[model samples]
Target: MSAPTATAPVGQTDTDASAPRRPRRKLLFIGIVVAVLLAGAASYVLVLGPDAAADEAVPVVEEGAVIEVGTLTTNLAGTPAQYARVGVALVLSADADQSEVTARFPLVKDAAIAEIGRHAAASLQGEEGLEPLRRGLTERIQAVYPDGEVVRIALTELLVQ
Candidate 1:
């Protein structure tokens, strides 16, 4: 005959099987808690983080300081005695010599006037005409100084009549 198998008594459970299940249940609970925490953290970052950051205005960074070139009234190229009144400023590069620029301010103004004098009165009347004028002024002012000394030319005011 075959040997009889071992069996637990009635109303009793196996200790080994039950012991392993307790640790598994605890681990499952801990894993669920960790998942919930991560979800909460992600939601907070996605929803509320940008609003807190939006309160401050971002500042614009310019390459260097601006030197006012004052205003120049010059005769336009067209006939009928047309004239243009232009106010401009020079933005110096970071490494430029301020003293030299200040000493030669008159030459900077002269360069701007010469550029403006080349354009016709009708050409400087509208916004479309202003861009070319600005580019021309920048190039003209750069010619007055060494390369890279003048970073940009800012035209503050322009009136052609």
Candidate 2:
């Protein structure tokens, strides 16, 4: 008869069985660590995002205001016939100081005169044309002074030959 096979100790079986589970335990530990890190990153972004944005924002100016200029005369249709005469009054706005309006007067004048000449001659065709010219002039004036608004463009006098 053969000798009885050697038997492992009873408690040693449990140790042998647990050996294969070690890799799974390590993976679970890594997953938990990753999850914790992600949570911490999310919390940090949520808490400090607005503060960081605020730091980059520009400051507000409270004392800013606007100024308007009255009527100015300029040659129409690039001619001095004295027949195609037009008058334009601009209502412009400025910051707290009126210098901004004064400084931009030349630009304003050129733009207004050119626009009026272009629209006025055609607009003299009929009463309906006059409304369109008024609207066009107002819009043109506003475009010239985008930062400073044009409240109105009063056609004090419009004559075209």
The best candidate in terms of TM-score: 1
RMSD of 2: 11.9
Q: How far off is model 1, as Cα RMSD? A: 10.3
Clashing pairs in 1: none
Tens digit per residue, CA lDDT, model 1, 80-131: 5899889998898877888888888888888887899899988886779999
Q: Please, what is the whole-model Cα lDDT of each candidate in the order they appear?
A: 0.84, 0.63
Predict model 2's lDDT versus the native.
Answer: 0.63
Model 2 spans with C-alpha error above 4 angstroms: 1-83, 93-97, 120-122, 125-127
